[model samples]
Target: MSSETETFSISGPSHLTAIDWKNTYHRRCVVASLVQGVYILERDRQQNRIGSQKALAPLWWNFFHFQLNNMLVDSADHSIFGAIFELKPCLNAPRFVIAFRGTLIESGTRSRDIHLDLKCIVNRLHKSSRFQLAIHSIQETIGLAGASNVWLAGHSLGSAIALLAGKNMTKMGYPLETYLFNSPFVSAPLERIKDQKVKHGIHIASSVVKAGLTVALKCQHKQSKPQQDDPFVVLSYWIPHLFVNPADHISSGYIDYFAHREKMEKIGAGKIEKLATKHTVESLLSGAILDRISEPLHLLPSAELTINKSDSTNFRKAHGIEQWWDPTIHCPSLVYQYRY
Candidate 1:
């Protein structure tokens, strides 16, 4: 990430509160599970994970608000469902998943080695991948005598890999689905091959907020204006702002990006030089990543978000928000509500 970005620009995406000014997505009960991110789930009427100073006062990292615990959570179904990997037993599902970790700390490895390993994230996302299909079966392979794998799902960076798999699945005629990151900081979306694949109906990677809208136009999903359900494609994203909010920064697992978070808090990010989320702003340099579709190369460095001001209650204070956001774009801004 650029030090230039660290100091000044308040993000347009972070300022956002509502996509459709007339309708707030958080108001309607959506079907997302807050298994570990408890605090952020019950946040303000707005999607911004911060509730109140009372709820926020005690923590060392005020912006680090999404709550996940070293505490283990269990599911009783004859299977294992988790953040990194899932193992299902005796389930007669046709597909299996070969999920790979994006980036994890591995002692004694050079940064070069670390970047190479991160490609495993994409390795699992190849389309029509028998290997990916076989990943979910590992659970049954060890536990049950014979259990088939089911569908595949990924969030954020993982979602991008899943999308890659969805495309291959389209060619091979397999059922695939995914939920990718919104404008990932990793790589730009593959467009030409993707745009032409519309009619064949490949497995699609749904979105929390459509990755296309938030990415640099160069990085928009590989398709033209997207439809809600095109298999092998990115999904729709609504509340793009919350993720950029200081509160949602910690939500994505794998703390490598935490370095920027830590730096931003200690040395306040300068003014919002430009909003990266609304359009494609170049991503911070890939800290340690090696991928075919890396997002950094195609970033624009100045994009604008389209938010509705009436929706926001305040202006953001560094150390208060989790993501690096600029206040000028079109969204709910904390500038009005906060004085810190």
Candidate 2:
């Protein structure tokens, strides 16, 4: 057997051999493979090697009995950012999956992706053309297959795109099942602080400042309280599944963000926590400057946060999409549900 085949042979569970959709691990492994397929697809295209076995779209999708239905191309850089896979007949799986590839720093799409990453950091990703295209593709998919039959999955920057798109669709009354792997959380690296008391103190201070700012903004603008139908409030019920490694600074902030909210509630500061959790410093600043409220891409109200407890000390390995599918890793998770 060729080395390439050997390398990918044990990548993960095969859908042809086992159909266990009820298994959370099995579902994670399959969805993660589909996301990896998008990465390989883009890599193969960039290298001018489309049909190589390194392209796991065919090998993995064929094993899962899914066929590529469409390629989501980025109009700015002409890079393939995502794909639509439809299950073949006689398969027991999601009818359709819209999977996205994350940033490939070493590839041709590096510049375009890095630009989008910057946009994400500033809470301006929603205005980007790539994200607009993603939203349109998802809308078209739902129109054709209905939202219940479709699943959304992405990694890193791709996960941010998926997240924004999912939020948009959910507001329009189409809640999707989303899987976000190592999604970037733009914030200070509080998770890196080893001293628990110091980290907690900083978190409390940050939350107080944010909550105070929100109250001041409301008083200045004479704006009424948010209604029950407000998009952010409505979004609290549509929880996405988030996978992160504690060692990955880019994504680990989510752990701190959600945990701090719980701590605030425990101390009878739920009101401050509520306002603070709904807005980020970047989003608040952008909103004040532009005279329009902007939602931060990473400020999720609810999520099934899965933290991988793998012993790998490498940043690249910790933030990698492949780790989600690694059967040997330990992933303990908690559901963070927001209450009004």
Candidate 3:
């Protein structure tokens, strides 16, 4: 019993077993799936309203105000979906889960904000005006709850929004964690276009230039108004857990690749060294197989539900949120087997 609870300052891959990392990965995956489910629900309702020519009301506000007051208030500026929960005493801490809805189907009433999507890739400040307003709404709700911590989660485009929002929120002195599922590469990844020779060359050159600029910016950041606990540094350490499926081309099948790289960097920080070398090792042993290979040796045919059966016309299903939480299919066995 003493050995199990022993404390030491030693750090390395040796200190952490494969099972520990597996459990952590699976746990985060489950949370990501739940977040994706929330986004799916929000998206579905929005689409339904669009089809019927009626705007979808922000239903989360009802729950938000219900816990605080009996009177119902309608506010239309809140574009993002979010919920507030009243937990048991042990979990009495003020908590929030802000879920962002994915891309609009036709951009019928949202054309002006479309440019923000592309702009966000280059400038984090270029978030959609809707998201900007949503942040204000979130802040108001947090004030009402006296929230000490926030969890930002989203799927697809929402994931991108969540990342930007989380970054900004942390800068504003909020303790937050972001869980992103099948998040598309807001900034292009070098590996994403490796197969395209022309594009790969262009990406490589761009990467070189970007690296130089990044180094310069870091140097400038260090010299100008250096605070002991810089928010950007805090944000860097609070790495967003990103979950991706190999078939999820919206994420370019490389989001997991980048995430794996960052994960290794995080584990190997300071005196700690990463144990797993290959992404497959982490994915297979950790039971977080977000990536699916086209061909697997001795591969038993997984249930059809695991794979999207939709035609090309239904690209949305290809990046479907449903697949993330489908216990009968994509979900890892460990998730459903235990309480998590």
Q: Against the true structure, whose TM-score is highest?
A: 2
Better of 1 and 2 by TM-score: 2
Tens digit per residue, CA lDDT, model 3, 1-340: 1111111111111222222213544334334433433443344444564332242222222222212121111133223344332322224222455666555444432443355455544343333465665567557656765545455666766666676666566557664656666566533344445465665345334434434443444464453534435333444334555555545566643433333334434544311112121112212322323332111111111111112222423456457554443333433221100000
State TM-scores per candidate.
Answer: 0.26, 0.94, 0.52
lDDT of 1: 0.26
Off by over 4 Å in 3: 1-95, 106-113, 122-127, 146-149, 192-209, 215-232, 252-315, 328-340
Candidate 1 regions exceeding 4 Å error are: 1-101, 105-114, 117-149, 182-340
Best candidate, lDDT: 2
Per-prediction RMSD in angstroms? 18.5, 2.3, 16.3
Worst 10 residues of 3 by lDDT: 296-305
Candidate 3 structure lDDT: 0.41
Pull out the clashing pairs in model 2. Answer: none
Residue 34 deviation, candidate 2, in Å? 0.5
